[model samples]
Target chain A: MTHPAEIKALVFDVFGTIVDWRSGVARGAAAFLDRYAPALDPYAFADAWRAEYSPSMEEIRSGRRRYVRLDVLHRENLVRTLDRYGIVDVPDADIDALNLAWHRLDPWPDAVAALHRLKRRFIIAPLSNGNIRLMVDVAKRAGLPWDAILGAEVVRAYKPSPQVYSDTVEILSVAPAELCLVAAHNGDLAAARRLGLSTAFVLRPTEHGPGQTTDLQADDAWDFDVKDLNELADRLGCPD
Target chain B: MTHPAEIKALVFDVFGTIVDWRSGVARGAAAFLDRYAPALDPYAFADAWRAEYSPSMEEIRSGRRRYVRLDVLHRENLVRTLDRYGIVDVPDADIDALNLAWHRLDPWPDAVAALHRLKRRFIIAPLSNGNIRLMVDVAKRAGLPWDAILGAEVVRAYKPSPQVYSDTVEILSVAPAELCLVAAHNGDLAAARRLGLSTAFVLRPTEHGPGQTTDLQADDAWDFDVKDLNELADRLGCPD
Candidate 1:
């Protein structure tokens, strides 16, 4: 797979690719569980917490409920995760603070360097499920030098939705061909590729924590595939 | 005036404030008119073209017409300006290309450095009447570093509508106090202040060209009244 010559902007999928959410959440949850409740299975709890992401968003998407930011959604889902495991000792303030752990999620080592390099040539932004405020908070915390932040909050539609990707490109006034979607998830890239967007796959082998299996390899013919964002930047000509 | 600690972000009024639109349009129009018809008074034509902005937008606001982007509004206004000036020699393509002069407007000298310095400490975006694509283009052309671009296109409500400014703060998830309205126009800043946003008045004495009369001096006790954006940054603790 080759880079499209016309590609001028690169939009990233943040969660698994740019930030190691699984391990970050796991570490944060493990630390909390260790101090608060040693009896809980931290790994299962981490998986369960992430498991709620889809259905929680679905509740809003299907119009079953009004729009809720990821922070609120995360708290709602956290209570359920705790209830299922019979662990209710955590206080509300602690839970509220912990929910913001999403903001402090650590990026992949290669993430910052790659983005910094890529920013030199392309208009770089994160087209993510996170809300604008959440993304901005994360960027400031992680020092991710994003040129702009474009998120589901702007369009009120989550990724894999053609509207989200198309609206993003339209907002930038760049042809779909000039924008590339870089992600660790195949489904995200596949959706973007279908909409005439170029695609790049950056492998995040440990994104799902210790037993993670999927997305460890680029299973599709994306425009570019690299070990990390720094390599992608090198390939894109971001100077050292 | 003391800096409002509550204001964490600053949104700008672009047209006459950050960019010298009158001169830009006049210069571009003169070149365009010269190429099309040698006889038209480019200065009067520029004023005539600009004179259509408010009424055209008002038509959309009153539901007398559909929501038309500033680009389309400029084109419509340009045609009428050409007709009034008896300029019959211009082709449609040239007119269409020249109507994009708004996109090519030059930034005021203080605009870039002030925005750049302020961006180091806070999130900076344009809360302008320009459509999304137009603002994005202007930022790229003028090298204005914005964390995100917010405009009337997002809310479909023009400035001073409260909905426009409030929707911007809501979308960015910043409280009204956490956002400052920085503009050369009192009407715009007044509306923002009414909505509980902090106000910063930067004087653009020549915004209306040499015939400018109003907004030559800051009238009210704005939170910060500075000569330029750099001065604003210096007051705000941007590094020297």
Candidate 2:
């Protein structure tokens, strides 16, 4: 087992790891749909909208488009998804409000308390694909006690790009070995591990819904494998 | 007086505005000198070291050097100052620690409490020249409750360059008029004002020491002028 003594900071993958984005988005979409397109299935609407997340980022990653902040991309994706559902003529204000639903995600039950505990001993922050504004709004809404805001916007490059991890390490002024990347997804952890950063996996069995087959548990021999954030904090020796 | 209702975020100038860098550096220098060079005048050393700050940043601003983080600039400036004072041969670790004294700056007496009050109503952060690591360290040490970190490294540009202020506004996803730049220095507020951001001036008479002649009071027709952060918070309608 790797010792947690030297880790000075823990950067998190925000969407599913810290907040229940799936449930939050579904709830918000349902409310919006209930008011407008009452016949639409809100859960399917949310899942389809989320399905576009990576492809939207891939456009910038492949240099097919200039880098746009996540908020703009979210708005664009929302419009396209609404079009696919035969829902049109949505007011700009309503569309903007629905797009900001990403910022108001509710943290998992254990997230806030565990993060407060972790924060007492380590610098805690989100290294998400979300831009600074989205992350800031999430932090405020969800009561995440972040020591700093870091993400693709700061480096102007998305994750899985070596630049994102390298820039985070540089900006934090810590060696890769002295920082830990905590995520529910194996891919995020794998990338951090490849870059020589320590990795911790916290299982989120239903992250992609009950049928999720992948990342139901740690897939790689990460530095730490914990059931939840509280356990991760305990493993890191943060006081209860 | 400008209404505070529209302002959603408050971005600060860190060094002289929030933290008393001059006194903090002097205290840290005195401690270092007591062990290594007891005869040295620590205040003069601290002042001489700070005197290099603007010029060091000017190198990057003028494109004479690539953009480097503030910690790196502080280290280089420390080395040159030590050499000028005929003090050399310090251990690399000691020099590094001494350079990081900038990260241990003490917030002004009213800073923490006032910031807590203001944070309830507005998103408060340091839009500083200091990089993320330095800002995070200072926040941890000084108990400044910053909502997010925004600064030079995040934008890859220094203050007074229109890019820094503009990038910050874009990242916060707020209109220039909807964000406020609060600083002790007129130059910072002036730059922000030129870019259409609201500005607040808080007096920090001893920021450059008791003999300070500049920035003793608001020098422009700033949107708000007050004696301290507490007064600024009061004026902003943040509950006491």
Candidate 3:
């Protein structure tokens, strides 16, 4: 949807759309533990840890468990990933500090610039599943310029859940048609689209590293399709 | 409380602490239709509208009504205040537009500079009763540099409600003592302190009006008591 003055708010799906989390976590992990596990393939370790994310959140989304913040989930996943990799006896304090890697992820090359431009026009924020603290860290460290952080902790549910999108838009006081979700994930955009939230897809070709098989292109008729946030800014008429 | 690196989050009470809402609404109301209510005391109109605030929120805080966003409450108060002043037949749209004066408030002069300095040191956010949209507008327009907006709607209750304080601190994943609330009103700080949240009293002697009778001095031994945000920032070791 065009970002005319009336387009009240635009929410983003953060992980792959705004930041390259895989590379970011890999780098952070390597920095934290290259000496402890010299044979560790950092990128593979990043994938292994991330693999735990969905199932843990699914437990909550399915009502089998109550809501827990992403920071807790990330640390839990971290411990399990370390065990599988035979990295043992790491100090709890060290583990806790390393878990903040999620908070320090690097935004996409186009993200900060595009978001700054968009901020001048739209009430832009993240509707990611990351908890409020997580979103706040990522925005501060990456210069995201979000007006507020909204997601899992606020709504007590994970993404793709209808309430995650619906309740978030309600908090921003924007109708579904006036709220847009820009993401690299079709599943997320499709969920948002089902609830009448406008959608934009940005290609993150290497999000899962070179052999990435999913979300390489806009597979559905999203409201807008772009290669990156810069293109999104252009489409939304944000000037250079 | 000292704002060392350990002070994880500093949540602000926005209305009088950060912004001047009374003069703001008065200006907007006068501009919206000065001819219709030429004899209207703009400041009194502001006070009349604000007088309904606590009683309305008290309904929710007392569990007699469900939580409502501050924007809705403000609009409701505005309509009632207008009727009391003998203004009639104003369209709903104009009232709605004028009610947004809360979103356009001018920050206390020290707020922006001090907050910018404080932002570099702490995770600063507003823990006001304003809804996400209203906080977003106020922060965006006033350049308050908040890391996130955490408040009433997010907690699903208005302030002085223990949940409002407890839940907001939980969102930041900080211990109660690690989160400091800086507000102009002694009562707000007192409520925060009751729940083990650290408190700072920034004196806004004129928050209610020139002859404001309450909260003129720190009534309790708050963790930190100062005359303004600049002094608060200074005591916290944020450099000029």
Query: Which candidate number has the best lDDT?
Result: 2
TM-score versus the correct structure, for each prediction: 0.89, 0.98, 0.95
Q: Looking at model 2 chain A, which ten-residue stretch has the lowest summed lDDT? A: A205-214
lDDT of 2 by residue, A35-124 (tens): 888988777788899998999999998888988999999999999999988888889999999998898899988999999999999988
Q: By the lDDT metric, which is better: model 1 or model 2?
A: 2
Name the lDDT value of residue A182 in candidate 1. Answer: 94
Ranking of all predicted structures according to lDDT, beginning with the best and ending with the worst? 2, 3, 1
User: With candidate 1 superimposed using the best TM-score fit, by how many Å does residue B127's alpha carbon deviate from the native?
Assistant: 1.1
Report chain B TM per candidate: 0.94, 0.97, 0.96
**TM-score of predicted chain A against the true chain A, for each candidate:** 0.93, 0.97, 0.96
For candidate 1, write residues A95-171 as lDDT tens digits.
87778778778888887877877877787889899887778878877888776677677677777778888988877
Cα lDDT of model 3 by residue, B29-72, tens digit: 88765766887788888898899999989999999989888998
lDDT of 1 by residue, B27-46 (tens): 88887877766777776677
iRMSD for every model: 2.2, 0.7, 0.9
C-alpha lDDT of candidate 1 relative to the true structure: 0.82
Clashes of each: 0, 0, 0
Question: Every model's DockQ, to 2 decimals?
Answer: 0.46, 0.84, 0.81
Once fitted onto the true fold, the runs of candidate 2 whose alpha carbons sit more than 4 angstroms away are none
Clashing pairs in 3: none
